[model samples]
Target chain A: MKRILIGALFALPALTAMAGDFTASLSIAPEWRTDNRDSAYFVAPPVVPVQHRSARQDLGLRFRDGGFNAQGTLRVLAREGQTPEQHGIVNQFYYDGDLGNGSGYTFGRKVISWGVGFGFRPLDVIQREDRRSLNPPPLTGVPLAAWEHFSADKAFTLVWTHPGHRHEATDFRDQSLAARYYRLVDGNDIHAVARLSGRHALEAGAGITHTSGEEWAFHAAALYQQRYSKTFNTLAESGGGILAAANPMQEVMRRNGLKAVLGSQWTGTSGFGVLVEAWYDAEGYSRNEWRRLDALTARQRSLNGMAPASAINGNVAWSSRAFERPNLLRENLLLRLSHDDERWKPALELLVTPRDGGRVITTRLEYQSDRQRVSFGLRFLGGAADSAYAQAPIKRMAYFEWRLALL
Target chain B: MFKNALALFASLLATLIALPALAADDIAALLKRADGYRLLEESVRIETLVESYRGDTLDKERRYTVYIKPGRRSLVLMKSPAEAGQKVLMLGDQFWLLMPDTQRPLRITATQKLLGDASTGDIANMTWSDDYDGKVVDEVDIKGRRCLHLDLSAARPGVTYARIGLYLDKASKLPIKADLYVHSGKRAKEAWYEAKTVDGQLRVMSMTLLDDIQAGRRTVVRYQSIVALAAPDEFFNPAALVRNTLAGW
Candidate 1:
């Protein structure tokens, strides 16, 4: 979008030069979904056409001053039958710079999220965030040039992420060179990361976090991607075809991928909480590649009336884009439960996929104050009955938001 | 007869170690005179604000900066706009937070350090002769001032309050009212203190709290400045709380 309005006009002269720290908010959100017409990749009229309702609004802005920083958003959107849109993003626009003693440096497009599990974050190697997206927005930074150093308990960063970008087949816009290392020792913390990328060429990871006493906490992470990719459905990887005339998916590539997570939490001082996690994702999908794509989608729905129902609904809608991956399988598990009270906050989550038992479930609530904030959420999928979220095609989703702030 | 029972068990272990080391040196000199009415140095920064109310209306406000140093470090920074670039830190009984578009720092516990409306441990624990010790049990008068209570406890388990009662003021030792306690010993908030004098000293610039389990809220806080600043120590490192930015520190 005109490079996000020239990075929001280079952060509007640091928001009128000086007296820094500014913020603004507005939000609206909306969302809804449903569509799960008896699965087997439902396709009565959907070869990709699921909006079902939408609304957005956003505004958000931020500024920092001293070493400059900025954040942006604008959006507007609407949808249902479509038509209504607007944009302008620039989620971050950094500067930082300070190279005295403890060192510092950063430059444009920033959001740098070194990960540690909270629903899968195998050492996030440079903002690969999507810890279960649903009601998500705001976070679009990665155009780096960082350098940092600190000590007293240690820290180091290095970044070169997407800087001069090219060769991007994902890995969040690949063109990487990342690094991180942190420590804290006996009170745990620790972390590690490494990235290199021409599309996952050399990744590395490590993590830890520990807390025990005063309401538990624990974490773990792992990663190892020397290359990873997935897409598949070229007739369920060539086990002899059944139908195709257009979309047959296909993107493959693999070699030593791996991801991992493990978690634990327990909070209480009356604001109850609990979490438990588990993850693994050698680029998802593999219980024999989802039983050879569920036996080629049950042999293309058993050649229903002798072929041509638009070639079996366009081959099960291109095998339902493998349930739009984000760990469709490859062992997963999570459980959450929360509360925060003090202008309310609530949560509940559950996910599971232990090789073919698929499930999802979600719930949320919020309230906040001091310049508004309201939220609500819902989600659900399903389990067994031949998993993959019960022959998924989407089964309920809901949302709402409010926000306010306005500086 | 066994040498008079070993000289009466050596004078009862020498008056049980000279009576609690003379009442722990008079409760460490009255908690260093109630930590000089809420810190007057030993590295500082402060600024705070808070507010809260709700029965007499007001309902919310915040701003903070904190900093503090000397051993039990601190940090804070969360100058409201709904908590801008949040941060927390701590370091004696660990805590970290840094959330405002995450750059990862997390690790909190001590009951999530109580959060908001003046609780980053009431905005970076001012002082308590180092996390508290006990003794001066009572003297009481209260409404007519006299005071002296004490009764503390929590020489550290990530302190945020686990028994306190305080009071002080028995003739200017200052601190004036408190209750706080939690970890099931109930009484979750009462506080009070007010003090003034400013640039010519006397301190304790405001505090109020109240809440004892949500009963019309309250809060207050205040201290819009404190100064002395020491700051660097890699900004109390929790991985440098997402690269310092102590702004005009």
Candidate 2:
């Protein structure tokens, strides 16, 4: 650890020298919401039913300089009723500096790249909660344990991209090693990419990831990620489970497997377009002892104890710019339909502009089961032309958002 | 005699219809002449004001003291507030903005779009010739001033503006007014320039831009002075874009 720290410190200056330019901005927003539900959990019997109106305000500041960037957000939530009041500060800082030539170094909380082509964010990293009291208590120890803490290992990612396709690499936080290829077939341009990734675990474990895709108006991609890590007492304790005792012979098998995604976007000269996407993900874990333990008792095992579970999702969206104007206002309408086995979600959005150069009004309606979220907003888009020396001001639309995540 | 005159009138009408096509090639050649004066280094002060469409609304203004070297190398130092030394510098194709608050310069990539529509294209990619490929389309008088009108088109696609029509003062041979057409068939954004003789050289002192998209929106940029300065090559790097002090305001 000390040697790694020393090496990172030594490489910092070289990275700084290679890195150029930075910018930052700050924003503040105040929001209000109302709800009649008391918890995000399901129970057979009602425990405590609560009704509440809430108002919250947050200040967000973002700064990026050279190879370093930082963001700080502070949120204060005020609630009424039987629920407890909550306030918290969420701060995230990231720094990526060149280590030399093509190498780089990063610090603080950031997404990690795993393996040579695979990336895995442990479930813990994905669900770190700064304020837990704001959420209802979980019923099981597994969910409760998963809810309370952050990742133990600060993730580290190293990536490389083919020289010609460096732009695509940056989109995924520069953790891609892919080459972009193009061909002309029957006068139509065809583009494709292939990438490989690998993740190295701190405890002598590793995983591999392979992703490849061809995109034109239609895009098809396939991804496979597989990883394994040894089960230890610390992990058992962290997982808050008796897997250590119940299946002592079982080696903990942690895996995230993904399948192919076929998607397409069609936007022709008419400015009207449709995008359709479908993907399948097969994921979970397997171990001999764990399987035997699960077979022995129903009370001790959960449905996710199965070795593999597959999820399929599809989305279709359509957009049109049939009302576009030359210099004045442009208008577009969009409709989306999505389904992921358990949920069916649909949304309709309409954007209207009085003229090519004026303010815009937008309306959105989304529905999922019994939950509905509707938003009507207005925005003053920037002026249509450039100035002699200065740039235009940034614009944002006023909106209302409501989300219900059913477990 | 009447039959001969009718035939001559027919020939003149044919020439009138074909004149624009013949002149188009010449306009492209003339635009190349402007491109030849590349690799300029200058230190200049620029003041900009953006007016709101509504009356009595406060306009936006900014001031910058900038130094630009050849190859898109530049350092802009803001002079207004007594803040720490934060500067914006561009070296090569990379850009950097430095902030006094953080004491660091962040690198900016060219892929990032500025103001939504304009890509952060290579600053070095710009030349007077590359921007406007045109020919002398006509000679006309505007407000009793003889002017040479050139119809220009973009040599390459994806540029900020597609077409530009320049009206140069015939006597001064300098652009007095320019109408920049964005995309294609769009209403043109117009800019009127005022020139002055400085240090025995003709230079633009002030320019006003009227956006065709908005009937009343306008922006004016005034140049206060120009000076000569020298700086290191690396100072204009992408990392310099983050230097707040270097950003002239």
Best by lDDT: 1
Q: Per-residue lDDT of A296-397 in model 2, one digit per residue for the tens?
A: 222222423442211000000000010111111112122222222112222232222222222222233333222222323233333323210011112333
Candidate closest to the true structure, highest DockQ:
1
Model 2 chain A lDDT-worst window of ten: A311-320
Q: For model 1 chain B, give the 10-residue run with minimal summed lDDT.
A: B16-25
Candidate of highest TM-score = 2
Candidate 1, B44-130: lDDT as tens digits: 898888888878788778888888889888888877776678888988887989888767778878887776545788778888878
Q: How good is the docking of model 2, by CAPRI class? A: incorrect
Interface RMSD for model 1 amounts to 11.6
Candidate lDDT scores, in order, read 0.83, 0.35
